[model samples]
Target: QYNCEKRQEVKHISARIINGNEALPKHWPWVVAIYDSNDTLVCGGALIHEEYVITAAHCFVNQDAHEFSVLLGTTLRTNSSQCNNTPKDCNIQKKTTRKTEVPSKEDEEYHKASETQVICVGVESICTPIQNTCCLFMKDIAVVKLKTKVNYTDYIQPIGLPKNCEDPPASSTSYSVGWGRIFEYYD
Candidate 1:
């Protein structure tokens, strides 16, 4: 059983944490980076299934599903020399020809490494509770279906969801993980 009790002191601050430490590789395997057509980091998402990701609906505001891609199996958002010496063990080749364009050769090399097998997949469709107004904060969740199914690896996995709607005990601890601006002044 997982222990849910609080183990750290509480510090209230801004939306993003200040002076946050970097997470170790594979620490949060379910986390994925969402990118726009221009290959810009737009938002972060959670892998819930082989071909599905969950993210905030607002991320899709004025965005085209076809222009979005999901990257999995890597902890570092930007390419690093650390991943350069590793073997390409991820099964990204099988889905390379789908609607979503694979990452450029440079991008592919940037995310490739033995410790992590990075793969990029295109967004096939997006579903939300509210069809017309997905930008609303209420029901802000959006489910994105990928054009190809991603093969799981040590660095790529789905997060387990709660089976029932039950509040946790008062003493339980909760955590939030995502990619956001590290410094408030810098965009």
Candidate 2:
């Protein structure tokens, strides 16, 4: 079940959302990083349940369960300093692999067990409506089941889903979050 407290609003010069800015550990705790075997951030996911993640269906194209690991409790993609600064219950799973990616050789202290264990037990994609003409995209969502249950922390928890499938208010400020490619490099 969900077990995270509300994020405290802090006054800052930057806008509410911005690129390249490091996210606060407590803010949007349900947002998780989906990584590949080499520790590369492939996509971003939202924890909907202890053993379930909701992400873009395109991220799973040609990807396998064994090639992915979900990382939580940390904001830095490859570093665990954020977790190290947290209180108790900071544990990770340690497993050896052929060529795992470590943030840096000198930062061996952060080289701990992969904190999150994730496996795509099953994937359910939202079916698109049939169209006569070329269709770009439709219902581009998928739900992934985690093989191992996750230990909920202040940095890792599930988000509240709407009870009914209704469109949001037109003037609502929705957010798009991810650790994928950033606009900084595009220019």
Candidate 3:
């Protein structure tokens, strides 16, 4: 019963994600699957509850702190080349040269790059020791905690995973806007 609903739901989400709506902004808050020097997608997770993100347990088995960086509010692909044709308001870039003297190290030239802000996960508790419980299998699923509560802005939001539905919807499409490698390979 639930399996059938999940499958349909997945299809619905997939279609909507691929064919987005005209009224929605492109950015989406999500977990970044940062692979190591060896280049492997270790695990997957979702950001839920302020100060914590959910991910797979195995994602932390043999990974380093530096190797992982979460890029939230992004689409599946990181690159924005294909999204170039998007509206001007969505992308505002200006090239100006300015200099500021720093008290500590050295002078620096500032190029004001106006990009959409980056939403970071706080990651409250990770790999915390816990005793096993019923109905909770230790699988590849964990949460990331954010340092601050995400502002409830129209431009940034968490992906909605509807409950009670057995499978993912096959029509209520959704998409993840990120600076990933979507355009480089797409036709």
Best by TM-score: 1
Superposition-based RMSD of candidate 2 using all C-alpha atoms, in angstroms: 7.7
lDDT of 3 by residue, 1-187 (tens): 1121121112112224334321112323333433332333344455454344566555555543434434344323222222222322221122123321122222111111112533333232355334355434555454544434655333234445567756755886444532232222456
What stretches of model 2 exceed 4 Å from their correct place?
Answer: 1-20, 79-136, 180-183
Query: Relative to the true structure, how large is the alpha-carbon lDDT of every model?
Result: 0.63, 0.52, 0.36
Q: For candidate 2, list the clashing residue pairs, or say none.
A: none
Q: Mind giving the per-residue lDDT tens digits that candidate 1 earns over 91-136?
A: 1222222232233454455334423466677788988776565447
Q: Lowest summed lDDT over 10 consecutive residues: which window, candidate 2?
A: 117-126
TM-score of each: 0.68, 0.61, 0.40
lDDT of 2 by residue, 57-148 (tens): 66665656555656665444542222333312222233333343334444344334323422222122222233344442464566766656
By TM-score, rank the candidates, best first. Answer: 1, 2, 3
**Clash counts for all predictions:** 1, 0, 51
Clashes of 1: 1
Q: How well does model 3 score by local distance difference test?
A: 0.36
TM-score of 2: 0.61
